[model samples]
Target chain A: MTDESMTNGTMTKSQRIGEIVETSTTGFVAVSKTLHQPPALGSLVKVQLGGEDYAYGVVAFGTTVSPDPGRRAVPRASDEVYDEAVYARQPQLTRVLHTEFSVVLVGCFEDGSIRQHLPPHPPRLHYDVHECTSDEVRRFSERLVYFRLLLDAQGQVPAEQLLAAHIRQVYRARGHDAAWLERAARQVTSLLRDDYDRMMTVLYGIEP
Target chain B: MARKRLGVVTDGAFNAGLTVRLDPGVSTEEMRIGEFVVVEGEGNRYFSLISDMQLRATDAALLADPPREASPFIAQALRGTTTYATVQVKPMLMMPRGADTDFLVDLEPPQPVRTIPMHFAELHEATESDFGAVFGHEDRTHFAMGKPLTMDIPICINLARLVERSNGVFGQSGTGKSFLVRLLLCGVIESGLAVNLVFDMHDEYAFGKESEDGVFVKGLKHLFGSKLLVYSLDEKAQARGGRGVDVTLQIGLNQIEAEDVLLLAEELNLRATAEANVGLLTDAYGADWLSRFLAMSPTDISAFCEQYGAHEGSLSALQRNLKRIERRPYVVPEAPFSVIDEMVAALDKGQHVILHFGRYDHPLDHMLVANVVTRRVRHLYREKVERYEQTQSPADKPRPLMITIEEAHKFLNPAVSRQTIFGVIARELRKYHVTLTVVDQRPSGIDSEVLSQLGTRITGKLTDERDIEAVLTGVSGRSFLRGTLESLDTREQVLLMGHAVPMPIVVQTRKYDEVFYAALGAGEKRSAQLDIVELFGE
Candidate 1:
């Protein structure tokens, strides 16, 4: 079936977040000039350059790094002082530091269909990145094939953790339908029969 | 254009098997072990049976990671991300050149599938045509033994493949081996494929036996109608006070052979000297020797033995063994019914016979009568084979005869297999239009050679590992089927395999109700049935 049908024709303009800074065939790194908080480690991220043409990816790794290579010393606000207070206290830090997260390219919505693999080309430079609409994530996840890409991904963060974070973000996005949650949990047991601890952790992530 | 897309193949060793990452909508309950499924590949569809299953996270590490308690956010994170179900399938058949074709050719020769199609779908549960092709069409002789565990598809067994050689019905006690044999016999009678002469030791097959709950279970005669002619010693009829006897069979001393008396040595507890003389006496006095030898006086016996070059002590010992048979009232010098001639005549007219023990259900009585009747039946069948061979015409060939012997190990045990006629029939009676349906509880006790020769085996629950292994003797894939047989339900369910069925399968035995009797294609079911519906309606 076509992605148009899969989206149920409800996909509108998604929330623009950042711009692409570095890219590769399997994954890419993007930097937002200032961010309240980085997108959760494994949330779905989209990079679209034009109409109906986009690359979909999972947030495999995320961190806030200073933009300039020299002078790596960055100010830190202690836990007692929260986001608004830290921003007020260190205005200079915001211009120097940017929240950067890496994305493992999972699939593409190209030629009007959802493709569960690396797209033919990387998104053009400086293309606006967005948090896929809840409906878009739901449609992309109707089949869980993309998780295989996340599992196959080789990155600094553990695939299991990234997978756990991805499921959590999707669950929060999709209204947390209990039946769907139960079904997804069942799917977890099937894929993780061995290595009980890892399965337990994954189950732990989905326990609500 | 339309089908339930099950999954996509991935991450499997092409040589070992195929692994399917199931689709999200497909639940865990669908992929069962031993279930048949069809994999859609390029230019062909492969038929496979699921052997093993697993569910796990995409990352191996996530499976064991825990804080002992699940975090709500973490739990939702794990839901659709890392977890999936995979089924391990062993491909059995491949319809090469097209995915839609139903011809099931072998998947052997080890063709390497370096990659699958872009449109590869893991598999869906096999359709009816797929199962029908694999199990074969049910013809007149093709009756379903039971339904497969995956679905309600009947597992049909070809009786022709079965009756061509010896067969065995084996299970532990109360495992419904008798009922399985009864169903098989019904198939045999319905197809008119063979005539069965059952030597009923428990007398349960010819006459209904009372269940523990005080219900009377119908016997084979009721289901078979006129097709089954029953022969008994008339003791049960006498006890029933003129309830009637179908054919009063009296095994007079005239029908006793020297071999029959020799078979009784163990039960009679006679010395080996007596067995030696019994063999000599058969050569000396011939077929009617039992009564003749018993008639001799002690002095006359010694004189006759001395003249015949036999030991005097041995002759007296043989005389002692002679008394066990001489004392039985049923073994008269003559009887109204001749067991051998009547059996041959009934078989010639295409009638199945059941020889009941009446009051003499002892091992000794059963063995003696079985030895006598089967011996004569074997000889008659051999004669008919000779006539057919000489005539070289299908019309001259006698109808195939299958003899049902309960407590088979007694007659076909390793030690007795060397000495008994039943053992030879068990091993070497595929030809001569004769076969045997040997029933026993401890199949381990039967001769391994005879057990291996069985063409079809219908076994219920057997707890003993040796009994289970012994049942799987000649069959292939012993290791694969061990768990299945070990877990059999100890009731009407049975594991039927061998020449009859297309594959090893467990089936819930068909009910022996009015429908069963009706399926036999006979007239009214016999008088033994309790018609609750008729009584209530009236």
Candidate 2:
């Protein structure tokens, strides 16, 4: 977004990428500000409730469709105008189609401390959602209690794939810390101790 | 080695021992049986031995459809979490952890484990100080036997307890049984806790013998000098070359008795009537029965049997057996001194004696001579003990004596053990100040009663199951020790158990080399200094 939003302990209007459309204690649904676009899948995103109190989640599932189920859009373009020119010709199409993503609630930041558990209350309706800064990712990944939530997610994305993606994102944001990655892998292993197939799937996905 | 962190206590029982879950960094291949380990409990520290190991996985599905071959990623990830190793620990002793551990006033000794450690107690490799605390440091009464399997510190044995009752040293052939016996004899002589009368059947104890490595090892004479005496039976065989022969032993025919013949029924191949026939001869001829019976002709034998109402066949069989003893070069008819009495006198003066069987190494010669000499010595010891008890005089009290014999099975088998002098001494439990040091290769051949009565057992490698069972006859935790005993290294390792040590331990026996010689020298100097202090009334 903007340089100001990337600074520590500060948030800016330019960094707001989505708004909450639905809310619950376990997860929430959000709509991107732009049409037919969502933040990269499995990215860390947080919603500020009030002063120094925020709720965090990881992207689990995403989709794009017309706003109304009763009305379907029919094909109106010929071979000469099938690319971006069709988007320019029918400007109203952008307003009708929207991008939506499902999030799994992992942890919360409350009273000046990062708690790796669900928030006391879900984020308010229509709150602004922003991508987590690199400092937030490093501090949150130091403890891996949130991995259990991601592994237990019952969303469209496979739980193993979602967990692996979150681990890789935090690994890169923490300057490629190999020791931290090994510890995180071991934590995952201990959690899925009885489920060897899922453990192997996650370990193979997050190699290096 | 430094005390290393091995694992934690997961589950176990008081009788079955403890189960330790190995740490992620510790591999199963690095753990070994008989290695000592320490466990930190809630309020105490436990000394345990590694008895077994196992590799386990959390899920059975992992074994059914395993990961792809050569996939290091899957193998490394599953190494410690899903699949891990566990060690079976047999906790033997426990020491309290607190201010009482200070050794200034009185050392806090390790007690037998009455309870198991708490859950998740951390286990570590035992250090040298742990060994010194459990098995005491070497001093006047405690002699250094060897070191533990993993450390270089000396594991001393309580020599005073060792001499209080009968002891055994057992192993198979070529497993250093002789070396261990020699080391023990050296300790006995140096400490002077008891006087040794060794019936050296192989002549390996008096004069130095060549070791299996082709190096010459010194015997008791080389170490004790004037304090030891060597007596040989074969004077002509003395040309083979050694030093120090204080007496050329010759047993007068009158010195031999009918009991000696009865003890050799198996070696002499006598029938069942031989015992009754020998009794008739001893009753008719009194103390000179053996010499008189050997000199009889066929007519004299028939006349004696008819007069005594004894079986003719049995009388003839007795004569045949008596001829074997008469043919021995050491046996004489009527012209020699009482060497058996002189041998007893030497033992009474606290000078150790070794009766070497120079060239007469047959079982018949060994059995007959050992039984005869030991019987006389036992009688004298019994009379002295009785006189000392009646008068309560210090001068009348006899010096403690330990009779060492090799091929112990020949003298201690179930059929003959009840009549033999060695068995009597073993059962008496130092009552008359006489005990036995039995060295044998086949312990199963010995009586189970005598085996159970042994005070301390220093055992080397034995592959036979019955032999192992016999050695561990009445010992506690026998099932655990069976595995440890069977896995001993064939060369320089032994499992020492019973009264001599605090608990059962596997030791890498100290090599009988220059290092041990130097240690012996240092021990002599220390004891000499103590003697001086006592003389000056310290």
TM-score: which candidate is best? 2
Instruction: DockQ for every model, please.
Output: 0.19, 0.66
lDDT of each: 0.74, 0.84
DockQ top scorer: 2
lDDT measured at residue A9 in model 2 versus the true structure, 0 to 100: 57
True contacts kept of 2: 0.81
Interface RMSD of 2: 1.3
Cand. 1 TM to true fold: 0.75
Instruction: Give lDDT: candidate 2, residue A129.
Output: 89
Residue A31's C-alpha lDDT in candidate 2?
A: 92
Cα lDDT of model 1 by residue, B339-426, tens digit = 5787787787777898878778778888888988888888888998899999989877788899999999889888778678898888
**lDDT (tens digit, per residue) of candidate 2 on B1-538:** 3568988999999989999999877897786687888897988889888988889888888888777662665577677778888999999899886553434225478999988888999999887777877888888778888888777889999999999889999999888998898889888877878889998898788877789999998887787776788888888655556577888888778877777788888888888888888888889999888888888998998899789998887788778877888898888886444676777777776678988898899999898888878888888889989999999999788889989999999989998899888888888889999999999999999999999999999999999999999999878899989999999999989999998888899998988877887877777777766644532446
lDDT of 1 at B100: 48
The numbered model that scores best in lDDT is 2
